[model samples]
Target: MAEQPETIKAFVKLGEFLGDYCQFAKGNLEFNEDQIKWLHKLDDLVARAASHNGWFTQGNILYAFEQWSTALKTDNLKKWLDQYDIQNSNPMTVAIIMAGNIPLVGFHDFLSVLVTGNKALVKLSSNDKILLPFFTEYLTTLEPLLLGYIKFSDEILTDYDAVIATGSNNTARYFEYYFGKKPNIIRKNRNSVAIIHGDETPETLSLLGEDIFRYYGLGCRSVSKIMVPRGYDFDNFYKAVYSFKDIIDENKYANNYDYNKAVYLMSEFKFLDNGFLLLKEDAGYASPIASLFYQYYDSKEYLDETLKRDADKIQCIVSSRPRRDHIAFGDSQKPALWDYADGVDTVEFLLKISNNN
Candidate 1:
């Protein structure tokens, strides 16, 4: 196997290839014969990924590619890895249980294991089955040394030195029971929220709409709730997000809107509606698709305390405030390489385990 610097170079090349693939995907790249064949296969995957999981829309899949292309730059990779003391050591088999919420949801974990020189035993969620394996194959082709370092399995996870699993709250209990004894990073359901200060520009709110509607709000990074100042009007918020109003035209989204609306009506619950989106006064963080739950906060101090109190349940907090923990508006989906999921440093964990082994 190659050394650390060589591995990084190979992955950087993989990033360049993905950048080209993204352009090819958009029909903007002049394709050579090899590029044409690669694009055809990638096109097939993008076309059919959503059929297995309706939430993995074509646009969302492409957006994922765009984000990753930007992220995999050589400078980005170096900066992300610079803070950690990565070393050459015995490779441990790290089993990853991927979540199928959005396209490539478990990619950060997979990347963490491999980039830190560990073997990845990936069990894909049936919802997101095709894209990562295809990417892995591409990676191995770029650097043949990766052939033995990556694996995909459908059987029960075994022979792993450490574990990383993402699942809903209920499934977490099972993971804890089965893999609790091992070094692990297990993630449960968490949602993002936006703190609206009542002075946000129409443009700002429009960007926030991306944080909400991206991937149909299936990603843990997607904003499902908003905390607004008391008596904040819904008119501007509704108008700003109207750009995504056509989302209701999609059959699955329309069905969700119709079904959720009927349930709210039957239950005699009061919720504000702008024809396409529903807004309700709810204290919960996880909101169903087609609807947004909101709470009215009195002060920044209160909002800060409330957020800190429930920090374990939240992912990204979208705000313009200059707090260390808050991510700027619209940036919730574009996490940097070091922005570890659940705030756990996956790379550091891998480095530590690999060094010990």
Candidate 2:
């Protein structure tokens, strides 16, 4: 395994480069000659990534880069690593089957594998093939030792000591069947929900719009449902989210909104529409894009009980209330480095696999 400090230093360098590039791209800072050349090249690459996948809009890809730029800071990496004994693990190749729900959605798993000194055999999602490989190649330029540690394969995955797979519920069953005998973390479909109060101001609800509209509500942590007090008036909710009305301007988002709305109208189902988004009264947690599923809750206790019962199907709860389990409004997408998906400790799993090997 490469020395731990060297790995951390390389990651921090990548983070700094990302941060600087972001500032330069936004015209907030001037880059040096070499940086200017490379950044202009990066601008072209970002456009190529957007072209490769319509969902990977330039803005969303940059947002993902900016988020990870902050997450990979030296202090943040140190703090997260301090939580476990992440050293001296016998190197093992980890096979990672990633989902392409959002930009860099599979990156945390990639980071977990490499930071723990484990080689990664990653099968990049077809929709997200461009960015991760670009960055990994960049990482090798900074730290040559990482060259052999990272492998992206479009063919069959083989010679892996452990597995980490993420996909929809049906694919999860297949993953379990094939990888169950090995040390693994197989993540299934999960959705996030928001618990809101009737008395809350529209200004507050507007912030919740970020949770629903960001990434077109495609991520597992995106709020797919909202539970409000019984008979809660939605007038303010509608007005608050009117600020995000421009989302309809995007071709893909508008197509979904138009199609889903047509289906609801043809089926004669009752729903609230505010020109851009749909609010349907439903019991399900996973709502279609451009729509939010909502339910009426009579009491806090009932909400708590229902949430507890549906824990496995939920990734995070969005609430303004003070609860350790709850993420603040608009903050679900900004998960910390330690916020492992499915509540499974990736680092610990890797350590165990290493020890067993």
Q: How far out, in Å, is residue 35 in model 1?
A: 1.7
lDDT of each structure? Answer: 0.88, 0.89
Clashes of 1: 0
Candidate 1 residue lDDT tens string, 162-269: 999999999999999999999999999999999999998898888888999888888899999999999898898999999999999888888999999999999999
What digit string (tens of lDDT, one per residue) describes model 2 on residues 218-318? 99999999999988888878988899999999999999999999999999989999999999999899999999999999988999899999999999999
Clashing pairs in 2: none
Task: Count backbone overlaps in model 2.
Answer: 0
lDDT of 1: 0.88
Task: Name model 1 segments beyond 4 Å from true.
Answer: 1-4
